[model samples]
Target chain A: MKLLEDRIRQDGTIKPGNVLKVDQFLNHQCDVALFDQMGAEWATIFACKPIDKILTIEASGIGIACCVARHFGDVPVVFAKKSQSINLDGDQYVSKIYSYTKQREFPVIVSKRFLTAGEHVLLIDDFLANGKAMNGLIEICKEAGVVIEGIGIAIEKGFQEGGRELRAAGYDVQSLAIVKSMDPDQGTIEFA
Target chain B: MKLLEDRIRQDGTIKPGNVLKVDQFLNHQCDVALFDQMGAEWATIFACKPIDKILTIEASGIGIACCVARHFGDVPVVFAKKSQSINLDGDQYVSKIYSYTKQREFPVIVSKRFLTAGEHVLLIDDFLANGKAMNGLIEICKEAGVVIEGIGIAIEKGFQEGGRELRAAGYDVQSLAIVKSMDPDQGTIEFA
Candidate 1:
C-alpha cells in the first residue's frame, strides 16, 4: 500500500473538484508493475478469504481486476458490462447506477452463468467515490446469492462517503491508496 | 497458439449468425492463466519488434492488454476510451468506429500524452471481425506518429475481411486463434 501511495504522490495530479488524475499510471495508461504490486498487497490483506471469482465493472476496473486475479489462485474475472451488448444474452443479474463522469445512469449486468449462488467473490475497482457503482455490484452479488468476501479498491477518496459507507455496512474494504484530502491550488494530497 | 485453439474448441460455443462465443474464457469471464499463455505466445511471435507500449480499446481489450503487457517486459498498456468522461481532457487523437454489438458509431479517443511520436506500439484487441475498430486505432496511430510494431488479436474471423485487410496493409498480425468457419446447427468450429 505504501508503494501505491508513493506512486500516486509522485505521478498523480490534483485537479479542481477533488479530482486526482492518476491516469498516467492508473486507469487510461496502466502501469502493470504497479498493478501487480497492488495485487500482491491485496493478496496479503485478503489472504484468508475464499475468493472464487473477482467481479468488477467494465472500461476501468477490467485491467486491474485481471491483474489481481492471479493473486487469488487464478480465479476467473467477471467484468459487469456498463451497457447491453448483442454478445450478452440469457438470464442476468442487473443493477443500475449513476455515473457522474458520464452524467447518466448505466446498467451493470452480469450473466447468471458467471456468478452463481454460494460463490465467494471479491469486488475490485479503480476508484470508489460516491459508492454508487460499488453498491450496484453489491446488489448484483446479493441477487446472485454470491457471498461477498471483501472489496479491493486501488484508490479510494476518503473524504467521500463511499468507502465509509461500505465499511459501515460490515464489508471488508481494502483500498490501496485513500486520498484523505487534496488541494488543487497547492497540488498536495494527504492519504488516510 | 495451440493452447488457445484447444481452449476455444473445448469451451467456445457456436451461436447463430456466425457468432463463436468464447466469453467463457476469452472475454466476459476471463481466464488469467490462459491470458498469460497468450501473452507468452505473442511474446514469441512478435519477439523481434521493439514494443514500447500496448494500445487497446476499452471494456474488452483492457484486461487482455494488461495481461499481455507483462510478456512485453511489463510495458505500459494504454486503452483508448470508447466514450468521453470528465476524467479525460486535453489534446487527443480521436477516430470513429461502428460497433455491431452496441449498433452505433462510437469514438475511440486516446490522449496525446499517452501515444507520443516515435514510440513503438502494438495494437491489441479481443476480437477482430471486420477490422473497423482496428482501422480506427491504426488511423490514430498514424496521426500520433507512433510506429505500430504489430497487431495482436485474441480471435479473428478468417471469413471476415479484417485480418485479410490488415495483412494486405502490411501489418504483422498475430491472432491466437483464427476461425475458418462455424456451424450453429452442428455446433462445430474450424480453425484456419
Candidate 2:
C-alpha cells in the first residue's frame, strides 16, 4: 500500500472536483507490475475468505481485477458489463450503477450462468468514489445468491462515503491507495 | 496456441449469426492462466519487434494487454477509452470506430501523453472480427505518430474480412485461434 501511495504521489494528477488522476500509472495506462503488487496485497488481506470468483465492472476495473485473479490461483474473473451487448443473452443478475464520473445511470449485468448460489464472490474495482459501482456489483452478487466474501479496490477516494458505508455495513474493504484530499493549486495530494 | 484452441473448442459456444461465444473464458469470465499462456505466445511472436508499449481498446482488450505487457518487460499497457469521462481532458488521439456488434459508431480516445511519437505499439485485442476496432486503434496510434509494430488477437474470425483486410494491408497479425466456421445445431466449430 505504501508503494501505491508513493506512486500516486509521484505520478497522480489532481484535478478539480476531488478527482485524483492516476490514469498515467493506474487506469488508462496501466503498470502491470504495480498491479501485481497490488493484487498480492489484496490476496494477503482476503486470504482467509473463500473467493470462488472475482467480480468487477468493466473498462477501468478489468485490468486490476485480471491481475489480482492471478494471485488468487488464477481464479476466474467475471466483469459486470456496463453496456448491454448482443452477446449477453438470457437470464442475468442486473443492477443499476450511478457513475459519479459519467453522471449517468447504467445497468451492470452478469450472466446467471457465471454466478450461482452459495458461490463466494470478491468484488474488485479501480476506485470506490460514491460506491455506486461497488454497490451495483454487490447487488448482482446478492441477486445471484453468491456469498459476498469481501471488497477489494486498487484506489479509494477516502473523502467519499462509499468505502466508509461498505465498512460500516460490515463488508471487508481494502483499498491499495486512498486519497485523503487533493490541492489543485499546490499540486499536492494527501493519502490515507 | 494449442491450449487456447483447445479451450475454445471445449468451452466456446456457437450462437446464431456466426458468433463464437468464448465468454466463459475469454470475454466475460476471464481465465488468468490461459491469459498468461496467451501473453507468452504473443511475446514469442512480437518480442523481436521494438514494442515500447501495448495499445488496446478498452473493456475486453485491457486484460490481455496488461498480461501481455508483463512478457514485454512491463513496459506499459495503454488502453483506449470507449466512453468519455470527466477525468479525460487535455490533448488526445481520437478515432471513429463502427461497432458491428453494437451497430453504432463510437469514438475511441487515448490520452496524447500515453502514446508518444515514435513509440512502437503492439495492438492487442480479444477478437478480430471486422477489424473496425483494430482500425480505430491503429488510427489513433497513427495520429500520435507511434509505430505499430504488429497486432495480436486471441481469436480471429477467419470468415470475417478483418483478418484478410489487415493481411492485405501488410500488417503483421498473429491470432492464437482462427475460427473457420461455426455450426450452432451440431455445436461444431472449425479452426484454421
Candidate 3:
C-alpha cells in the first residue's frame, strides 16, 4: 500500500469539497501495471478466502477488477451495469443507488445466471466514498444468495463512513490506500 | 482467435435484431484468462506498431483494454468517459456517438491531458458493428493529434459495414471473431 499511497501523494489532486482526482492514472486513464500490483496485494490479503467471482460496477471498476482477477486465479469478473441494456435478459438482480459523481439514481444490474447460490464473491471497485455503490452490490449479492467473501477497494476515504460501516456489518473490507484527510487549498493528503 | 470463436459458438446466444449475447464470458461476466489470451493475440497482431497508450471507451472496453495492456508492455489504458462527470476537467476532446443497444446518443470524452500530440495509440473495443463508437474515438484521436497504430476489436459483425468501412478508411482493424451470419431462429452462427 506504500506504493499506492505514494502514487496518490504524487499524482492526486485535491479539489474543493474534498474531491481527490487521480484520473491521470487511476480512473479515466489507467495504469495496468499498478492495477496488477494492487491485485497482488489484495490477493495476499484475501488469500484465505474462497473467491469464485469478482463483482464490480461498470466503467471505472471494470479495469481494476479485470486486472485484479488475474491474481485471484483468473476469476470471472461480473460487473453490475449502471442501466438496463437491451443485451440483458429478464432474469437479473437489480439494485438502485445514487451516484454522487453522476448525480442520479441508476440501477446496478447483473444476470441471475452469473451468480449461483452459495457462490463466494469478492466485490471490487476503484473508490469507496459514501458506500452507496458498494451497498448496491451487496444488496444484489444478498438477493442472489451468494456468499460475500470480502470487498477489495483501491482507495478508501477513511473520513467517510463507507469503510467503517462495512466493517461494522462484519464484512472483511480491505482497502489498499485509506485517506485519513485531504486539503484542497494547500494540496495535501494524509493516509491512515 | 480460434479460442474466442470457439467460446462464442459454445456460450454465445443469438437473439433477435442480429444480437449475439456473449455476456456469459465476454462483457458482463468477464473471463480474465480468455481476455489475457486475446491480449496476447492482439499483441502479436499490433507488434510492429509503437503503442504508447491503449485508448478505449468506458465500461466494456476498459476490462479488455486493461487486460490487453499487459500484452503490450503495460501501456497506459485511457478509457473515454461516456458522459461529463464533475471529476473531469474543462479541457477535453469530446465526440458524440449513437449507440444502438442503448438507443441514445452519448458523448465520448477523453481528457486532453491524457492524450498527447505525436503519441502512438491503439484503439480497443468489445464490439464493432456500425463503427459509431470507434469513429468517435478516432475523431478524438485525430483532434488530439495522436498516431493511431491500429484498432483492436474482440468481435466484429462482418454483415455490418463497420469493419469494412474502417478498413476502407485505411485503419488496421483486427477482429478476433468475425461473424459472417447468424440465425436466431435456427440458433446457428457462421464465422467468416
The C-alpha TM-scores of every prediction are 0.99, 0.98, 0.99
Task: Pick out the ten consecutive residues of candidate 3 chain B with the lowest summed lDDT.
Answer: B81-90
Alpha-carbon deviation at A31 in model 1, angstroms: 0.1
lDDT of 1 by residue, B37-85 (tens): 8999999999999999999999799999999999999999999999998
Q: What does candidate 2's lDDT look like per residue over A104-142, in tens digits? A: 899998999999899998998889889989888888887
| Candidates ranked, most accurate by DockQ first | 3, 1, 2
Superposed by TM-score, candidate 3 places the C-alpha of residue A84 at a distance from the truth, in angstroms, of 1.1
Candidate 2 residue lDDT tens string, B105-170: 899999999989998889999999999999999888878899988999999999999999998999
Q: Write the per-residue lDDT of candidate 3 for residues B1-192, one digit (tens) a residue.
A: 999999999999999999999999988999999999999999999888999999999889999999999999999999999988779986999999999988899999999999999999999999999999999999999999999999999999999999999999999999999999999999999999
RMSD of 2: 1.0
Q: Which is the better candidate, 1 or 2, if ranked by lDDT? A: 1
The clash count for each model shown is 0, 0, 0
lDDT, ranked from best to worst: 3, 1, 2
Error of 1 at A137 (Å): 0.2
> Predicted candidate 3: interface RMSD?
0.6
Off by over 4 Å in 1: none
Query: How does the DockQ of candidate 2 come out?
Result: 0.88
Every model's TM-score on chain B: 0.98, 0.98, 0.99
Interface RMSD of each: 0.7, 0.8, 0.6
Question: For model 2, what is the C-alpha lDDT against the true structure?
Answer: 0.90
Docking class of 3: high
